[model samples]
Target: MMHRTQRQIRTDEPSVAAEALSVTHVTHGLTVEDSGEGFAFEERVRGTALLSLESTRCTGTLSGAVEPGRAMMIVWVKSGSAVVDDNPVKVGRPVLYRQDPQRFRWVDVQHDVLRIDRTIVEQVAAERGDWAPGPLEFRPRHVPEGAPLAAWWLMVRSVAQEVLQGPADVPVERERELARFAAGGLLTAIPHWPVGQHEPVMASTARFARAETFLLDHATEQITVNDVAEAAGLSVRGVQAAFQRHHGITPTMYLRRIRLLLAREQLEAGDDRSVAEIARATGFAHLGRFAGSYRQEFGELPRQTALAARE
Candidate 1:
């Protein structure tokens, strides 16, 4: 239920903010308190971002140990000033909660504020950019400026409306595209090294086919990025860029999928090996995560696959 595609919840209770927003800080044990004068909170969540519009009788404080994976939390203070962690969050200025999620502590939300909390990552954008993939961090700035900021906000709003407002059960490919666009926009908007996005490379079916052949051949081995790169006669980044461009998937993801298929094939063949042994033999080192992934992809775990084969 945590990965609900879209949700719109409105509550007048200030007590529900913490539970309503399953953000890292709050869920990781941040204590939040709003002065109980009059409060209205609305949360709109799409696949990759959580947008909140909160108006409280008084300001609320988010205090506790910071949880990680806050790739980006762009906070725009619609009205009164907020105090984020130890710093003052000025009105009309966008406060970025994390360039580093681990270093961030807390947020004190002022009354009568409409805020935006964008969950961001640039890595998923695939081969659209030349920038080295890593955590998309921003410099400490009160108001995030320029055309990209406005453009990104606008795009997110448009995508949210389309995805969240659309009929039930948005398709999986559309969801994946949404994630790629959001992350791609962030990468375009933010100031980062290896500057500027290269135009998206057209997918090369031949290249992907070649890579696929190599991967299928060595699917049972513990291959690293370097190995793939070397076999492909390209640099690591080049391999990633190529796979991402052509297949809309990274080499690692492609390898994992192939391995999962191999594992399933083995299971369905009713091989004498146990599930754990088969998983290990197929280069799925973490048995639990492998089973989880198998269930997700094949709609049955490895054990179930074996059972179905026997039956």
Candidate 2:
């Protein structure tokens, strides 16, 4: 996973020395690393942003601004101290944070920064609203020197190590989940502050919940309403209600959304299958409807998206 980030370098200006900003795509989310080292690197992944610096030692007063729809950000500070609006935040440990319109924020992750995946945060948060952490605000906590945010460091290290050391079984999503869980724990442990709320009930309700498991397992097949209902031992209406209550959407709509999302990925990746073939493979048999839905959701026909991607 890698996000495309904007990069800028300014060596002569007194106000700013040098800068390399990258919005990195790490399994399940986006992270931005900005540092003014001797060099810079930037690339785009799935249309998101990423920034990277060769080293944090040259970084002076690092800061990040996240847009409104960007789920939440989990900041992992490998070194240095960060000040969010003049308040010093302990660095080195992973800090899970979010922001809302009412509570706009300015974060300084200080040194050796890694931004976690927002997609996973938003996805899980959307489904599990109650467990979601609220928007971030300034909080100053004492640092137990030399002990950076250990949990976050370990999680990031493990993911990085896997990227360098593991095999196909080590999917990015798994690494992303590990990071999310670790960050969620840290956020939960932090002290109270006035902030907007997030719902995480979907996560809790879907955790070990049979319906969710079944939906994920069978997302690619021609699963019918009756089949899903039977599998979950509920009436069709009951299952439909469950999806609506949990995901804020109807069951059929949820299925289509997931299917379309999968189809889009396949299309972008240049999968050999044709649009109709891919749609059918993902359980949508009607070519016209599939194409129309694809166009509406992605702002382009399936074939067009694939063609553009190939170019």
Candidate 3:
């Protein structure tokens, strides 16, 4: 197949999300707008692709596009702050994010823009074995600002913008390699659990692994930290520390990611299901709370998701 060039189209109507899929081809672009509340866009993507989006104004949540055969690396390109799972991320330097294939993320995006690339990253990650863990949900733990991986990503961002200007002579494999280099730097920066001055703690590792497995298997049910800790034979504190050390978030936030992901699948499929029905089906029992979280997790509300589905 011939290499496809990225395309950009602007719309002012709240109802234009329906047009995203007709393009068929992959995309990379920037969105500039003023809305206390942000927005969302979804498209099918395969192969390695890169997208950089930086906002000059606005702060909101971003959700959607989590599925198998897809991978993304998102960076914060603006100078400001956004709350991830209620945790604030200071902006300016880019934040590396991987989408969880089995779940959706409630990314706190500030006025800063985001850069995203799809399949090419998966291929590079395949070599590293870290890619198969599924899309990463949390920011990779603290790596110094000028790390090699960070520098490489900065380069990729420049190249992505160039490709947008005009078709380049670079081969697809070369583009793929560039993506690989970026992914390599990112994976290396992820913080490992139980990393301390001592050896890996068996008690901590086992507890964390068990809790993670339980959450993945039972995301559809109403669950709590106590339940997860009991199931994993660990104390609540232990489970919390494990997630914090490895993923940089609490267990509850992780579960919310799973719940939102299920809701997104229904919303994107454009099924006959109602928005409220989707909320309940996904284990969100309260309509108001569900709508608020859904909106916070994604830049748009549940109704918008259903509306996009109909399109």
Pick the TM-score winner.
1
lDDT of 2: 0.47
RMSD of 3: 17.6
RMSD of 1: 18.7
Across 91-194, the per-residue lDDT of candidate 1 in tens digits comes to 54445555333332333343322223233254442234333454433444535433334334544555555555565555555555555555544543443332
lDDT agreement with native, every candidate: 0.53, 0.47, 0.50
Task: State every prediction's TM-score relative to the real structure.
Answer: 0.45, 0.41, 0.39
lDDT of 1 at 118: 32
lDDT of 1 at 267: 87
Residue 207's C-alpha lDDT in candidate 2? 29
Candidate 3 residues 10-62, lDDT tens each?
44432453244224312223122334555543322222245333332223333
List ranges where model 2 is wrong by over 4 Å: 1-208
Better candidate by TM-score, 2 or 3: 2
**True-structure lDDT of candidate 3:** 0.50
For candidate 3, give the lDDT of residue 196: 29
Error of 3 at 108 (Å): 33
Off by over 4 Å in 1: 1-4, 8-14, 22-29, 48-71, 90-93, 99-120, 124-132, 194-311
Highest lDDT, which number? Answer: 1
Residue pairs with clashing backbones, model 1: none
